[model samples]
Target: MQKNSSSIKSSTDILKQAIQFIGQHNITAIPINYTVSYEYCRGHHVLLRQAIDQAIVNKQPITNEAIQGWFDAFLLGYDLSELNKSHLDLNNIVDQLASTTTQAEEDVNQYDTSLKECKDELNETLDTSSLSSIVSSLLTSTTAMQIAMEQMKQQITASQCEIASLQDRLALVTIEAVTDPLTGLANRKGLSMAINESLSTALQSKNYPCLLLLDIDYFKKINDSFGHLVGDKAIKILADTLKKQLKGKDTAARYGGEEFAILLPETDLQNAWKVGENIRRVVESLRITRSNNHEEVFRMTISIGIARYQANQSINDLIELADNALYQSKNTGRNRVTIFETKL
Candidate 1:
C-alpha cells in the first residue's frame, strides 16, 4: 500500500512539473506536447531527456512540431513488453502441443504392443478362462487407445484455435505499427514498404511508378491561427480528399507532420499531374469550421510535386525528385502542382 501511494505521488508530481514546464515555455498544451513534457520530467527516457536539454541549451523554442517529431522518433509504436509476452505465450502453446502429441504417440505405441502380445497369446493353445482373460485384456487396451486418440484430437483442435488467435493478434499489431493514429492512413514506415514493393513490381513489368510529395501550404500558420486541434482536422480533411482521388493500386501515407506521400503504380507523368491537380483543387475547396464557434471558418490548400520513376533509380532518388518538384510548387505559388523535369 505504501509503495502504491508513493507511485501515485510521484506521478502527480511529474504531472505538475510537466504542466509548469509547458507554461514556462509557452508550449501548447496538446496531447503530444504534454506527453513529451511528462516523459521529460520523469527523467526515465534518457535520449528524450538529452534531446530536450540540448534544445534548451541551444535556446531553440520547443514548438509543437518539434515535440511531435520527438514523440514519433522516440515514443511511438506498440510496447515491446506486450509483444514479448505474446511471443512467449505462442511458444508455450506450441510446446504444449508438442508434449500432447508425444504423449499420444507413446499411447499408440503401448496399445500396439498390447495388441501384439494378444495376438501371440491367441496363437498358443489356450483354455476358456485363458481366452476370456485375453479377450478382456484386448478390450481394455482398445478402449484406452480410443480414449487417447480422442484426447489427441481435442488437444490438436485447441492448439489450432490458439494459433489462429495469436495470428490475428499479431496481424493487428502489424497494422497498428505501420498506421498513423490520426489520419487512418499509412505512416512513414508503411510508405517506405509500399515504395519498395511498387518499385520492384515496376522493375519486373518494365513500367514505372510516379511519386507525389504533398505539403499543406503554411500549415504552421494555420496551427497558430486556429490551434493544433484545428490543424489536425485540416490534415484529416486533406487525407480524406487524397484517399478519394487515389486509385486502388495507389498508396497514400502521412510522410511526416503536415506532409503526405502518394505512390502511383504504373502511372505516367501526365496522369500523375492530373491526379495532383484534382487533389489540390479538392483541398483548396475545403472550409473547416472551428470547434469552439460555428460562425468561424477557415480554408486550407495543398501544394504537390510529382516525379516519375526512372530505371535504376533508388527510392530516395525518386522521393528527392518529387520533393524538388514540390519545392517548385511551393516557391512559385501555393495551391499548385509541379512536375519534375530535368531543366528544373
Candidate 2:
C-alpha cells in the first residue's frame, strides 16, 4: 500500500455502488454521484471508473466529509467559494487533496509570472545600457569602429531571446483566457468563436448545421429541495453528457446556468433529429445519486429545440429558432425534441 492507499481503496469501493447503478441503467445518470467514487464521473461510466481507479492507485484515504465536500466544490460548479467552512465540516481530511491541487496550479502560474518578469527586466536593462545603445547607433560606422559593430551584434542576439520569452507568455495568457478554469474545456467566448466560424462555413457550403438548446427541467425545484450543493451535481451530470455527445465539428456551450447549447456542422434535419433523440435518451436514462447518504437514483428528462442554419440569417437567428423549438418541447410535455419551422 502507498501513501493514501487504504483511503483510496475506500473511495473506489464507495464508487462501486455508483458504477453498478450506471451499468444497470441502459442510459447515463444525472445528479451523478460526484463524490470520491465518481471524481471523474462526468461524460460517461467509462470516465467515472477511470477517475476512481486512478485515485485508488494513488492510495489516498478520503473521508466521508471530504467526499461530500468534493461534490459541493466540483459538481456544484460554484464559481466562488464563500471561503466558508462549517463547524461540523465532516470534510476536513480531504482538504489536503484539494489544497494540493490548488497549490500546484498556483505555483505554475507564479512561475510563469516570475519568468516573464525576469525576461522583461533583462530587456529593459539591455535597452538602457549605454554600451548597447551606442553600439547600435554607431553600427553603420563599424569600419570606423569595428569593436562597436561586434558588440551591437551580440546585443541584438540577446534582445531576440528576451522578445521570444515575451511572445511565449502572451500565448499562455491567450489560452488561459479561453479555457474553463476547472474542466479545461473551452469557455463561453471560445465556444462562441467556434460556433460563429462553423455557421459561416455551413452557410457558404449551402449545408445546414443543427443547433440544439436544452435546459434541466425543474432545476430550481431540485436546488430548493436538496440545497444548492446537490443541485450542482445535477449540472455536472448534464455537462458530462453534453461533452460525451460532442464530436469533431460539433460544439457545446454552457449557454448560461442550467442551460446548454450544441452546434452540429454540416448535419441536416434527419441526422440532427437522430442526434437529438440520442441526447434525449441519454439524459432521460442517466442514473444520478441524490442527497441521501443511501443510494438514490435519478433520471432527467430534457426538452430540446433544434434549428437549422440558413444563409440569410445570423447565428443569433439559429439560436432563437432552437429556443422556440425547445419551448415547444416543454409545452407539448417536457422530455422531447422539437424542430423549428417558420410556420411554427
Candidate 3:
C-alpha cells in the first residue's frame, strides 16, 4: 500500500510570502516588523488579527503604535512556540542517542561471543587444515567487527555535529523570539519568564521581588508632533536610559509602546522606590537631538510606579498594584514616582 504524505512549505517560503504581504500593504518599516505581523495574521492569530481588522472596520487611521502593539502580542506567542519546539527537539535527540548507543553495545556483545566461539573451535581442532579453517573464520569475524566499530564511530561523530548545529539554531531562535527588535530589550514573553523565575526564587524564603511600571510622559504628543521615526528614536533613548540605571539581577523590559517594566530581585519597598526615583531622574536628564539638525533637541520625562511582591500573590496581582500606583503618578503629576501601599 502506498503511504499518504503531507507537504508543508519551508521557513524560506513562508518568509517570502511574508515579504509579499508587506509589499501588498505598502508598509515601509523594517522587513522583520511586518514579516512577523504577516505570520501572525496568516496563522489565524485571533486576537491580533481581530485587533487590526477592528481598527479598519471602525475607520481608524492605523498608527505605528497600533500595529506594534498587536505585533508584540504575536511575538509573545511565537516566542512560546519556539521555546516549546526547542525543548521537544532536544528531548527527541536525547532519546534517539540513547537508543543508538544501546544497539551499538548489543552489537559489540554479539561480536565478542562469536570471537569466543571461534577460539574454542580452534583449540578443539587437532588437524592442521581444521585449525587453519578456524583461524580464517576468526580473522574474518575480527575484520567485520573492526569495520562495524569504525562505522559506529562515524555515526556518533555525525550525530554530535548535528546536535551542535541544533543547539546553535535553538539559541539564535530563542534570542530572536524574546527580543524586541526596536529597543534591543526583552519583549513581554521574556519579561514574564524573568518574573516567574524571580518569583520562584523569592518564594524560597529570600527577599521579595519588586515590580516597577514606568511610562513616558506626553508620549502621544511626541508621536503626533515629530513623526513615527522620531518617535521610534525617543523610545530607543528611553530604553537606553533604563538600561543604564539597572544594576545586577535587575531586569528592564519594553512592556509596551511608551511603557516599560523593571524587575528588581531581592529588593524591598524602600530600595525599590529609590531605584524608581533614580531611573526617573536619569531619564529626565537625557536630551535627544534630531539627526537632521543638531539645534533641535527633544526633552522627555517619565512617571514610575513601584510595588513590592507579596507572599501568595500572582504576577498579575503585582502588576495590578504597580499599574494602580503608576496611574496615581500620572494623576498627581508627571515626572514623579508612586508606591503602592498595601492595607494591613
Candidate 4:
C-alpha cells in the first residue's frame, strides 16, 4: 500500500511538472491526457520534452503548429496503440471461442460413442442391473453434452460482443489517426486518402480531379507580432474559410505548418482556379482583433496554387506541380491564386 501511494504521488508530481512546462511554453495544444501519459512514456516523452526545451531555450512560444509538427514527425500513429490492444484482445477471444468449439466437438463425439455402447449393451443383455447402469451412463452423457453446448454458445455470444466493441473503438481511432487535433481539418494522411479516392473516381468517370495548395501569407510574422495564441486563431480562421469554400466531395487538410491542401473531385483546372481565388479573397477579408484591447489587430491573406490531375498521375506529382504554382503566387504577390501551367 505504501509503495502504491508513493508511485501515485510520483506520477502526480510528473504530471504537474508537465503541465507547468506546457504553460511556461505557452502551448495550448497539450491536453491533460497527453501530459499525464507523458509521465509514463519514454521515447515520445523525451522527444516532446526536448522540443519544449528547445523552444524555451530559443525564447519561442510553443505554437500549436510546432506541436503539430512534432506530432506528425514523432507521434503520428501513437494514438492507435489502444486500438491495437483492442485487436489483440479480440484475437484472444477468438482463440478462446475456437478452443470452446473444440471442447464441444469432443463432448459430442464422446456422447455419441457412449450412446452406441449403451445400445449395444442393451441388445446383448437384458439383466436389470446392467440395464440400469447403462441408462444412468446415458443420462450423464446427455447432460454433459448439453452443458458443453451451452457453454460454447455463451462463449460465442461473449466473443461477438467483444468484437463489436473493438470495432467501434477502431473506428474512433481511425478518425483520430487522420485528423488534425487543432484545426479539426484532415491531416496529411487523411489528405492522401481523400486524394487517392478522388483520383480513382476521376479515372472511372473520366472527370479530372484538381489539387490546390495554399499557404498562409506571412504567417510567421503574425506569430511574432501578436503571439502564438493569436497565431492559432489566424490559422483556424483560414481553415474555416477553406471549409466554407469546399464542395460536398472536396477535402481540405492541414499540410503541415502554414500550408494547407484541397482535393477537389470531378473538377477541371479552370473551376479549381476560381475556387482558389474565392478562398484567397475570403481569407483576405477576415479581420482579427486583439482579445484584450478589442482593437483590430490585422487582416489575413493566403496564396494558392491550382493544378488539375492528369491521367496516370501520382498524388505526389500533382502536389509538386501545385506547390510550384503556389510559389508563383507567393513570388508575384501575396493574396493571389496561380494556376499551374502544364509544361509541354
Winner by TM-score? 3
lDDT, residue 224, candidate 2: 83
Each candidate: RMSD: 11.6, 20.4, 7.8, 9.9
lDDT, candidate 1, 126-219, per-residue tens: 7899899999999999999999999999989978886786566556656666788799899987898898888778898988999999999999
Query: Taking the tens digit of each residue's C-alpha lDDT, what string does model 3 give over 1-344?
Result: 01211111233234345546555555544423554545554666777667767876897755566666766666554435534544454555555556567767887898889888987886777788888887788788778878877877876786677567657655665676678889998888778889999988889976889999999998899889988888898899889888888889888999999999999999999999999998888888888788877656578899999999888888899999999999999999889999999989
Residue clash pairs of candidate 4: none
When summed lDDT is taken over every stretch of 10 residues in candidate 3, the lowest stretch is 1-10
Clashes of each: 0, 12, 0, 0
Q: Residue 199's C-alpha lDDT in candidate 4?
A: 73
Model 3 bad stretches (over 4 Å): 1-82
- What tens-digit string does per-residue lDDT give for candidate 4 at 1-344? 46644554454344345445554555452332342234323233676667656766898755666666766656666643443443454555566667678878888888999999999999999999999999999889888888888888987997687567646644655676678888999998789889888777788898988889999889999999988999998888888888888879999999998899998899888888888887777888889988788788899889999888888788889999999999999999878999999879
Worst 10 residues of 1 by lDDT: 78-87
Model 1 bad stretches (over 4 Å): 1-106, 109-113, 116-120, 123-126, 143-147, 150-154, 291-296
What do the candidate models score in CA lDDT, each in turn? 0.83, 0.62, 0.76, 0.76
The reply for model 2, stretches above 4 Å from the true place, is: 1-169, 182-185, 290-294
Question: What is the C-alpha RMSD, rounded to one decimal, of candidate 4?
Answer: 9.9
